[model samples]
Target: MKLRFLPLVAVLLAGHATAQEAVFQTKSLTPEAALKAAQAALESCRKQGYQIAVAVTDRTGLLQVLLRDRFAGAHTVTVATDKAWTAASFKTSTLEFGKDTQAGKSMSGIRQVPRVVAAGGGLPIEAGGTLVGAIGISGGPGGEADEACAKAGIKAIADALEL
Candidate 1:
């Protein structure tokens, strides 16, 4: 009778373990995760001795995470978020859009896109070959400075499990 119970317990434990391993959960980007990503970007900017505003947004062009350092200008948060929105909406880097917008506008049959920040520091976050979101940074020495921070943040958060 004891041997029989032992076999049953072992089988039950094995089944429980198998059930736990079968979950196979996958990670997705969320607002909190976006905030972590923004923090990473902000840290990069700090290393460069630049105070900046960082923004992260979901695929729907909504701001998910936003940050502005103590020395960052008040308005930079909005600007950076707007840039992130533009990047997510347009599904392209703000830098490319900024430069090409003029040429696109200059050419016929191309109209300027509204609310698009062509400046640097805006990048689209892609996951599973899909546009998951975007990150934007501003209030640095220049657009380039802002962009560098944002890029670092995006890369850092790309593979992280979202909470």
Candidate 2:
């Protein structure tokens, strides 16, 4: 009986080892691409007569690039960065996250998390059907305007990010 149990344990261990060996590949946003996205977002807002700040972050919520228009307020920079971080960390747009959190009593606690900006202007960046980063805009007159700038940033790089 002891010998039989020993063999079973060894077989299980071998299977576990094989499962642990399985690996997956993931992609992340590059600094160059992040810069382009930020630039486009700022440009888009400028075209609309809005001075704004834009930030881009990798999948891990690490900022890769930031841009501030000449007349943007100082606070806009931090808001943009936090918005990008929040979107990347949560895997969704800040606008959607904010609405959902507000509507659900249990999820409202998410707003207390550090660096979580529950607002518009944050959007996850996707490449090859996977989330690779996020872009955020701030300093616009309203959330809608800020979100439009963020969308323009993603649109600028959509072709390059295609699978």
- Show pairs that collide, candidate 2: none
List model 1 lDDT by residue over 1-163, tens digit each.
7887998999999999999998965433687778889999999999999888888888878887778899998889888998898888888888777777665366322324556677887888888767888899898887778878888897787666333
Candidate 2 minimal-lDDT segment of 10 residues: 97-106
Q: What Cα-based lDDT does every candidate model obtain?
A: 0.81, 0.91
Across residues 1-163, which tens digit of lDDT does each residue of candidate 2 receive? Answer: 7887998999999999998789667799888889888889999999999999999999988999999988999999999999999999999999988888884667999899899999999999999879999998999998789999999999988888998
Off by over 4 Å in 2: 1-22
lDDT of 1: 0.81
Q: What's the alpha carbon RMSD for model 2?
A: 4.6
Query: In model 1, how large is the Cα lDDT of residue 160?
Result: 65
